[model samples]
Target: MTAVDFEGFVERLATVAGEAVMPFFRTMIGVEDKGGLGKFDPVTAADRAGESAMRQLIKSTFPGHGIVGEEFGSENESAEYVWVLDPIDGTRGFITGLPTWGTLIGLLKGGVPVYGTMSQPFTKERFFGDGGSARCRGPHGERKLRTRACARLEDATLSSTSPRLFSGGDLVAFEALEDRTRHTRFGGDCYAYCMLAAGQIDLVVEVGLKPYDIVALIPVIEGAGGVITDWEGGPAAAGGRVIAAGDRRIHAAAMDLLRSAGA
Candidate 1:
């Protein structure tokens, strides 16, 4: 009936996904190359299992709601309240035995992201937010999350999944961001956005993402007083090239650099 209720279900969904994925961690799991000959986009049994487990839970709890997932495709996509899932937001990291990967669970009401969560079960960490507030939970404890006040790009710490993930025009634009920021690091995926929400990283610029890749991150970032947008300064709900910043000034500056890169 309310978003709070939906948020609870999101938590359950994340838990289910975590359970399904943890079994495959560091187990020399089998990986299928989703990418082409020259690329390494990998998906494993854990990815498929995690998504399937979550889907079953969602269907049982909210049968009328639509579902959009990474592995299984979309179902009832026209329904008003849809659950967007990325069982393993960082499949590359998951396959590599890195704990940076997470299960992304998001709720979209009428096609706009209203709530989202990123769960790293291996680390026992989950970051979640509605449109207004964000929080993080882990083996240590739970605490409210808010983006740090960083007014300029030069003073910002930035991250991306990897420089290798970008190419052509997107690469040019991302390099422009890297050149402007204080420092840039690679390898984050969904964790980069959560780090921004925790006010650890100031900006996250990524390319070639699908809706499931970012829908869950949008609410958490926005709730923590950060901004998520495409390179053109548009809403990133549909996902593509994404730029998330902890401060408006920083977002503007990054967007400007992206525009110049396009020029």
Candidate 2:
């Protein structure tokens, strides 16, 4: 089936996921530490619940499709068509009662990202794309998504989930890029990427990411006429240290600084 055909189903998945997660927001929900000592990778019951709901829906609707999720492990991952999910992309923000978290749903065909959606139920907003085009629907009203042009780093606003995610040469590269930007903000997670797609942000640099963390964002950025790639200027579908720029000129400039730091 064509990617466009899955759009309706994707929204349904987002609805169910949001329903599963909203109950835990701003509540005293239990949390589990997925990371060991010296690290704080947090996961909540909300994360599992949301992913479980989506998984169940996918299994019932398209039994042959694969699923790769953050809370639940992969199933039939080598199938021709696969779904990548990060039910609560910003679990840290969720637990902290921040609305920056969202549910990310992505579809892959033949191992390539074809469609994606980022839904923030709290804000009643949804952003979606199909690599070629993108749009957003929210309380503010629906509009086509587009990245703003800012060709120079000095005129750009940058964002990252956190500086803690970087180290060694990666840290050096990110800092250099941050210094060149007009401003840098932290703690966006997937929301930062969405903002970049909406023409509100210019650059997003992140490291130590998994496929589930970035797969859904590829279409959103590309659809909005932005560039997303590894520090070496390669495909970002597989994750790892990645950089996204609203303007290709800024993208090329960021890559140069990253390369200089051996990132």
In candidate 2, what residue range of length 10 has the lowest lDDT sum? 254-263
Q: Top TM-score: which candidate number?
A: 2
User: What are the clash counts of all predictions, listed in order?
Assistant: 0, 0
lDDT of each: 0.90, 0.94
Which segments of candidate 1 are over 4 A away from where they belong? none
Per-residue lDDT over 68-169 for candidate 2, one digit per residue giving the tens place of the 0 to 100 score: 999988999999999999999999999999999999999999999999999999999999999999999999899999999998999999999999888888
Which prediction has the highest lDDT against the true structure? 2
In angstroms, the error of model 2 at 154 is 0.7
RMSD, one per candidate, in order:
1.0, 0.8
